[model samples]
Target: MKGFGLKVTETGAKSYIYQYRIGGRGSPTRRYTIGQHGSPWTPTTARTEAERLARLVGQGFDVVAQRQENERKSVSLAMPAYVEAFITNYLTTQWKDEADGAATLRKHVVPVLKSKSFPSLTRSDITAVIDKIPAGQMATRRKVFAILRKMIRWGIGRGDMPQQDNPLVGFEAPPAPASRDRTLTDGELVLAWNAADDLGYPFGPMVRLLIALGQRREETSAMEWNELDAASGVWTIPAAKSKNGKAHIVPLNDVALAVIDGLAGCADSAKSANSANSARRWPKRGLLFSTTGKTPASGYSKAKARLDKLMVDAEAKRAKETGDSAELIDAWRLHDLRRTMATGLQRLGVRFEVTEAVLNHVGGSKAGVAGVYQRHDWKEEKRDALQAWGRFLEQLAAGEPEQSNVVHLAARG
Candidate 1:
């Protein structure tokens, strides 16, 4: 306790310090700040800590340097810094959809646990974040917690986090959302198609393409011009952008091609407008449904809401003319379009294998041993099925009878 003393700042804040020399007489003195004067660090505790530091310093341990190193490590191991490290080093390298995982951490995890150190985060800290998500958004809650658990486990394995106990250990993840079987009815499909026509540009053409192609919403929204071969009438989804990690080719019929053609003008106009405001030059074959021309078009929620309003208005107008009660269209998501396409394809007498192929689904006919053995791409079958589906949609839009004969033709092909 020879070099122990209480240092009071100008503002009257007092903290304990241990002053010592590393090399003995004539050596430069170093001061190691133990802690502030508080319940955890009173005179007696501070003196005991200073004595412990004296023992270490007497043994040539360089207590000041060790304390500095510990402080630096503590800062680096804080939740915010560690989250970025987890995203950069682990998520980017390992996950196909790294952007989603990174977004989840930044949106849900970082805001709640910003001041917590990775080793110090309690189960309550994580639960608090998860609880903030709405009960209806179980999928989002599940994803956020899953990514956090994986990130912590990855950090522990790589020695970036403590190995003693994980905050997420034995935690029951939110149950997955129920599988939806909500396919659009024929009347609903026609109403939606008309609504898309009214919606116009970017999302309008994008929705039309979704109805025509039957791909996932994200996939259809993120479609690129380069993915389409206008001459060959095919759109190829690369494995990197695909959910299934396999390249999928969709044969574009007249309907899909017309939607793409309209989008070309829309894309140019959007790009020109964006470039006029900013110095960013958009690539010719960049995102097809972009407003900024730098990233894929988002705002699906707002877009879908507008589309739904249009559908409800159109249905109401029709009801007024027919003397029926005006009613709201049943709630439907953009994903329901895929199911609608598959259902319509089945009605069109498309083979089960071909329908699955058209959707690029890896289940039913394409699962297990059949998947391993049957390597047929069903290119022609898919083309015929999608073409018939397109014709069926066109007929619905034209107020003509839905073409059942095309199904027989497609079956023959």
Candidate 2:
């Protein structure tokens, strides 16, 4: 009671309360709730600890301030602070807002390098991570590296980490080997088209669009009703969602238009059947394809799983009928369908620039300059190009005018 202060109460409460004075200007008194009557801190022990704290405060120590200061000083490193800021601010706000970016970072970069000091990461460390991934995954490595570089740059810009050159700078992986030529041969094209037709649930239209337009898989899957201009025969992909961050205008051929029309019919039929429950059955927003009709399909994971099973079944059937080994038929991928379109267009004498523009690829030397200057979509040229490609595919499907031996000879020569 002499060295420390105390409060007494007489209203049937059996315990005394401890009191202390805070040392700033007003010197307001604070109380610590030790215990009621028969628990942990006895009066003597509470008094001693309070005396110690009081002594420290009397000497301008300010124990609470000191503890906070110690905590502030304890957070001295860049990596832990970065991780906190990245999880709270960057991942939650910026990266997560973008479609699939959070998953990409979490799956690819965070698992490997989240704990690493931004300043200490070296090109060799990055290359080691890259090397661990199996060969032929150059695209995946490139994307992971890009995400890491961006995160590091963000940290540096925000002053959370020291400025360092991005470790991914000049980091190059070996070219992925050209796997089996995705280009479908004339016979294979016919076979795949027929197969798609026989198994139609939209596979036929999907295949036709993939072959006719040569758009990326996700781009095709993300296509919305609002993006299509049936009258103008143009499908415009907005810049924000595009991989290149530029608006891409695809000139739709008659074949592509027909496919869209067919899909519209299917959608109409589904809606008609569900008319009584239309609000529940159809999505509020427009998506070309949706699961139960609410939001756009996020990924092709389910569809891809089903397709993989189908491919396995197709291979088994091929093996049984043709006596071909399993290895021979398991060689194709979905992306091969796009390659087939490109190769088929090339084989039909379409100009390289026209094909590249149709595919929305960065143009070649001459066309690159033209692409900058022209400012136009080159809609007419693209239309002609796509129409010609579609006609070629139709011919292949019909087996009309057999594929030329001369073309094969020229290819060999």
Best by TM-score: 1
Worst 10 residues of 2 by lDDT: 404-413
lDDT of each: 0.81, 0.61
Candidate 1: global Cα-lDDT? 0.81
Off by over 4 Å in 2: 1-97, 113-132, 164-181, 187-208, 266-285, 289-309, 315-327, 330-334, 365-368, 374-376, 395-413
Candidate 2 residue lDDT tens string, 1-413? 64354445777554545555665547876555444554555677776677777677668665666667755644533445555556566665555234355555565554666566656777876776666666666766766666667777776787655665656567674465555665656655555554554445544456557766788766776678788765466789877556666788888765566566566753322221112543212222376755545534454444445555555566568778999775343346567877778777788788777777777777573355666776656668877878777667656655566534212110111
TM-score of 1: 0.84
Which clashing pairs does model 2 show? none
- Per-residue lDDT, model 1, residue 247, is 99
Local accuracy of candidate 1 as per-residue lDDT tens digits, 139-178: 8899998898898888789876677778787778889988
Report how far residue 326 has shifted in candidate 1, in Å.
2.4
